[model samples]
Target: MLIDAHCHLDFPDFDADREAVIERARVAGVVRFVVPGTTRERWPTVLALGERDDVSVCLGLHPYFMETHRDADTEALARALDAHPDVVAVGECGIDARFAETLGAQWSLFDAQLRLAKERELPVVIHCVRANDQLAKRLRQLALPAGGLIHAFAGSPEQARKFLDLGFVVGLGGAATHERAKRLQRAVKSLPDDGYVLETDSPDMPLAGHRGERNEPARVAEVCRVVAALRGQAVERVAEASTTTATRLFGG
Candidate 1:
């Protein structure tokens, strides 16, 4: 089964037809999805969706919305994990140095989640950005539980190798679909088959042809198609490998 390791189905953007969206994605051969929590406010919604057969959930404090997090939120997330068996991982967490001025709270919240994951023994799904250096350094300092994937990874080959060596997979998606993303494409090409996974970060990072449109979980197939072509393999092989990698990371 194809698994979108990262998506935001709980977001209000899909309120009108979220079920229909999942149905269409299933019909399009996208069998499963992982929705990561952005804040305490969204955890209930994500946990509810994870009760469904096709959904897996991760409780986290997303860096972009770190301003919304509070101390209680972290404690609440910890208490909520055992409520469901499909609560697979503990993130959608990490740093986003693209806007470093607003990053202090984000780092604290991210570190909190990492500490929780370590204590809980859950893998993480990080959201790293231009702050690879700092992110990598902090990760080494904290030494996360079992490592995690860097969602929508856009980095140099050296950075790519560093994360892989540390036991993380490189998530490839829309960013590598554009021709102008030369460095990202190179990273994707150089990454080993066992070290790469597929994701859409849907309703956010749309592919090349569908730019400006709502990216959905179904778009993961196109990403598979593109990345497979880049790696000189068939789509099915890419699908199988990515499916296995995601299952290994997030548990399906």
Candidate 2:
């Protein structure tokens, strides 16, 4: 079974046909999805989705929407986790270098989530954009107990190695499907068999040929195929290894 290790299925983008979207993915042999929360307001929707058999949830404050976050959101996240012990992890949280103004706030929010993940013994599903080095440094300072994933990893092999050494698996999504992402392709090829997981950050990172269209979970199969070709391994082997890695990190 293929698992989309990171996706935002609760977002309004799929309101019209979320069920149909899930069905298509199921038909394509994608059995499970890990949906991460972006902000406090979206937590309920994410939690509701987690109640379904096919979904797992990770709650956190996303850096991109820094203005929407409140000072109390961090405590609220802790309360939500305490109230719902079944939550799989603690994030889609990390710093975004692109948003210069929110960098400081992002660090505080990310640190709070990391502390909560440690306290609860859960893994994290991180969202990092152009902040890999800083993110890696923080992870080294405050190590995760259950480990986690670095979603949509597009870094050099050296950077990927740092995250792997810190016990975090690199998540490869539609970004790697592009021929222009040779560095990421090389990282995918050279990563340890157990160091990578497949994802399709749907409604966001479109594949090479599917630009401008809304991405979906079914495309994870294509992601696996791309990773397989990059690694010179069979698609089934890639599927099995990634599935094992995901199951070990977040469970089935």
Candidate 3:
């Protein structure tokens, strides 16, 4: 079975037919999901999804929503993690250079969550965009005990190696499936057996043919097929490797 290592199933986009979406994913051989909380207000919804045997949850403040996050959210995240032992990670948090205005606050929030992950010995699910080198530098300094995932990773092969060397695994999603994504495809081709995991980043990053439509966990099967082709390996091999890596990183 394949695991969708990162997906925002808690988002309102799935509110209409959440069960049907998960059922479709199961039918497609995608059996597990990791749903992350982007804000303090969403933690309960995210945790509720985690009650399912096949779903795991992560809580953190997303950089993209920096304007909504308050100073107390980090402390609240700590309490939430303490209250929910089943929580597998501490993020959906990281730096996004696109929001230049909030860069400084993003770092502070990201660092707080990283420290929480370290103290709790839990993996983190990061959302990095155009800040890989800077994020990698901070990761090096912290050397978190429980290495995390660089969710929806769109970095170079060398950058992928840097994260892997730091005990973190890269996440491959629909973005890597595009024909013109040569750089990302090259990164996929260069990954080691345990260096990456599969994700859909549903309701956001639609796959190549499904552009302009909502993405869902069911499409992870296609991601596996494309990644296999990129790495010149069998689809089942990609599925097994990605599932194994995800299970190890976030637990079953």
Q: What is the per-residue lDDT of model 2 for residues 89-198, given as tens digits with 9 covering 90 to 100? A: 98888878888987888888889999999999999988899989988999999988788999999999999999999999999999999999999898998899899999
Model 1 alpha-carbon drift over 4 Å, by segment: none
User: Regarding TM-score, does 1 or 2 come out ahead?
Assistant: 2
Per-residue lDDT of model 3, residues 1-252, tens digit only? 999999999999999999999999999999899998999999999998998999999988999999889999999999999999999999899999998888888898999999999999999889999999998999999999889899998989999999999999999999999999999899999999999999999978989999899999999999999999999999999999999999999986
Superposed model 2: Cα runs more than 4 Å off = none
The candidate that achieves the highest lDDT relative to the unseen native structure: 3
What TM-score would every model get versus the actual structure? 0.95, 0.98, 0.99
Q: How are the candidates ranked when ordered by TM-score, highest leading?
A: 3, 2, 1
Q: Which ten residues in a row are the worst by lDDT in model 1? A: 77-86
User: Clash number for every model?
Assistant: 1, 0, 0
Q: Stretches of candidate 3 above 4 Å error?
A: none
lDDT of 1: 0.86
Residue 89 of candidate 2: its Cα lDDT?
A: 90
